[model samples]
Target: MWRCKMVDLLIRILPVSAWKDRLIQWHVPGCAACSEKLAAREEAMSVLVQERELVSVKDFWPVVNRRLRSGVEREAPPSRPAWQWVSVAAGLAVVILTSLWLNRAPFEEASADLTQKLQIDYIRIGDEPARAYVFQPKGVNMTLVWIEKDGEGE
Candidate 1:
């Protein structure tokens, strides 16, 4: 029952100005196209307002301080920095393990094969008492001296 100009004046003053009763009345009754146009206009206006530039950060600080003082607090969760020491330690561990593994000889390799290949006689001894046997693996003289004494258990 209010005048049409009264509704327009109210729309100009309200914050969410587009969803007024007068506009909805015409747009909802017999026109889908008009309703779509109104929705599109509202969306466009909202995007334009967001994209608009304000004054510098200096001028903006007062507004921010006012909001903060009014108990409007919003914060992001804290985050940790990248794992430098953990990564370095992991890398060092990997390097150490790789070095150890690379330096080791396999157990299944024949000692005779290595002795013959190297052309040097290296001897291995056991805990027995009779003789020092000589092994010529590829004609390299390797001796096994059996010491017949309780060297440590005596």
Candidate 2:
């Protein structure tokens, strides 16, 4: 059986309430993968429990009721200023332009190699112009194709 399957089986076959303690004591000492997974699960469960304790219906129901009566859409204005958004947009644009400029030659060479290696023919089902894109991701065994009709009610 797979290691994960064995770990799952051990967890399921053990006691219900004390499964974590039993699994840690019995199984995790021998299996490093299971021990790491168990630690991550424990951390996630502790964080979930802490977040659950922080939330209560009584804490927000009064504010919601008051807002419903007062018809206020928001309690506070937007936290970010307009200049911050503009600067963020400017930074994003710069990053995008820099990346595209750096990768332009490599992308063009790859596209030329791909077109030379693969021949794609479009099928016309009707009078619409069709677009077909074929791509194979690195380290993947599958090629994906996307076909779409263009110029529709624009």
lDDT of each: 0.55, 0.72
* Model 2 lDDT per residue over 1-154, tens place: 3866776877677667587567667767787776566557667787665655765645787888998888776566656787799899999999999999998878767776765577677645387667777877764444688777765436
Give the per-residue lDDT of model 1 (tens digit) for 41-75. 66777777453474443577888889888874866
lDDT of 1: 0.55
Top lDDT model:
2
Q: List the residue pairs that clash in candidate 2.
A: none
Question: Could you give me the TM-score of model 1 versus the true structure?
Answer: 0.19
The whole-model C-alpha lDDT of candidate 2 against the native structure comes to: 0.72
- Name the 10 consecutive residues with the lowest summed lDDT in model 2: 49-58
Per-model TM against the reference: 0.19, 0.27
In model 1, the runs with Cα more than 4 Å from the true position are 1-82, 106-154
Q: Candidate 1 has which clashing residue pairs, if any?
A: none
Clashes (N, CA, C under 3 Å) per candidate: 0, 0
